[model samples]
Target: MSNLDQARVASRSTETTRAALIKAATSVFAEYGYDGGSVRLITQRAMANQAAVNYHFGGKDGLYREVLIAATRAFEENAFLDPEELDALSPEDALRRYLHQFLLPLVKRDRVSRFLRIFAWESVQPSEVFSAFIANSPPRIFRLAERVVRRFLPHDASAEAVTFAMLWLAQQPMFFVRDAERLAQPPFSLKFDEDALERLVDTLAGLSLRGLSGV
Candidate 1:
């Protein structure tokens, strides 16, 4: 092979390896979690040797971080607004957008299942590593939510009120994914399709805004 051709081949091989590792890591981490997911199992799953983890990802912790990042990939898309754009938005508009953005992570059915199932496991039987991960890696959208929500709060908004509002909003997506069938029954028989869920964002935003604005 020519020098350039050989370099291209090497680059493709590297990309392939990294993608394999991330895919393997996602499954293994989802199955076993950070504490139980060993480097050995991950390497075996990826069909690579142990050293590949260190070479590509630095170490197991780094690999796990990448796995978490992949899990959240959907959420990160279109998650940021230019500061100027956000500053120009009215508080109600900002809160409405923020609430809609918050649920984007669960937009895909598979992503929703994996995310909820993995986190359910983590929360029920969390390890020290899980605690550290939560403590260190607050989702970026959370700060955005708080910033907009604060606009409607009194100067001395109860800290718990702010947190409570967030938790209540959080429950909507959880219920949509977790109790989907229950939601689709006789009296409450609501469509849980993507469009329906998207519409849900507007409903929630309106209800939440009224309460927050004391309308």
Candidate 2:
């Protein structure tokens, strides 16, 4: 219609194309990984021009980097509790909620799944790209957990002792997710359903409280 309306339409079109590229690239990187995933494949999947990748994202590496960041942000928003939420909870309750949120991504199977896949690939192959991101991104959840755990520990406990306690609490779910595939099958046959997850949070919280009191 008018010049201003045409400019607005063009801006919306650019954003749509960029989002499509990122979405398609995420799947490509997840399936074939960075080295194996090509610009042509990503563009074809996005239904955007090949030149659009370079124009919008600099190149394939940059696009993959963006995908990783977007995936992580989604997980953070889904799984991380705000400081206010923790403030409203008691020490034990906070710990339980934190653990529950931390484990949510494993069961949700959304964008975070692709993120986890790419992360696993990077862990085995040692990519500079992922390494840089990890180095830059401080583990915010660790700090939150540490604060909650401090209330359970003795007043005289050392910082190192508190850190070790937090590590113990955090490691349970981390290792569980890593071994989930095997645990899902026969023999163990664990299912992380809603009821199971509630029990899991309760059990872990109880163990942590007992263990912390002993320390």
Candidate 3:
């Protein structure tokens, strides 16, 4: 075979190994966390040589960072309205859209639940890599929430007050997502179908506006 053709085949093989490592590592880390998840186990799961992790990702920390960034990217992409779109809408409308998108991922529970599992583990015992990932990532949703929230608050509201109000608004769905399993069972027995979701969004929006009014 020509040198160029051989090089192309080698490139494909390299990427396949890298992708496999990431997929395996995501599952392992999600279940075991960074410290608990060993490189041996990850390499074994990937069916790749132990050296491949270092060759592709520098080491386990780098691999973990890639997995984290991958897991959160989809949700981050879909969960927020563009700032321009948010600006065009009235505060009530913008908030409703934002909250709707926030809850939209709940419908894709299988995929989103995996990501949530990874996040839950990290939250309890964060890794240095996860901290760096968060530090570098843009705070897209929070900024959107802050913009929507400012419309509700007086112009003179302090930064602390604005941040607190944003957290309060954002926490509504965050709490729901975190407790989704528990909320599914029990007396709540809540199902997040289209009609139910709309109602919940409306309820939260109403509560948020009223709650913000007093802030």
Output the number of the lDDT-best candidate.
3
User: Which lDDT value does model 2 have at 196?
Assistant: 83
- Please, what is the TM-score per model? 0.58, 0.65, 0.74
Tens digit per residue, CA lDDT, model 3, 1-215 = 99999999999999999999998897787557788889999999999988999999999999988887776675567553677788899888988887876665455555545565565555457788887887877345556778889988999999999989886776676656555657788798877777887898899888887887788
Model 3 scores worst on lDDT over the 10 consecutive residues at 105-114
Clashes of 1: 0
lDDT of 2 at 170: 63
Q: Which model, 1 or 2, shows the larger lDDT?
A: 2
RMSD of 1: 5.5
lDDT of each: 0.65, 0.75, 0.76
Q: After superposition, how far is residue 34 of candidate 3 from its true place, in Å?
A: 6.8
Question: What would the TM-score be for candidate 1 when compared with the true structure?
Answer: 0.58
lDDT tens digits, residue span 68-98, model 1: 6665564465334443455589977776666
**Residue pairs with backbone overlap in model 1:** none
- The weakest ten consecutive residues by lDDT in model 1 span 74-83
**What's model 3's TM-score?**
0.74
lDDT of 3: 0.76
* Per-residue C-alpha lDDT of model 2 across residues 1-215, encoded as one tens digit per residue: 99999999999999999999999988787666677778999899899998899999898778877887797687578754676778788887888887787666456666766665555445346567767876887344556667778878888999899989877776666555545666789999999877887888788778877887788
What's the distance in Å from true for residue 2, model 3? Answer: 4.3
Model 2 alpha-carbon miss at residue 11, Å: 5.2
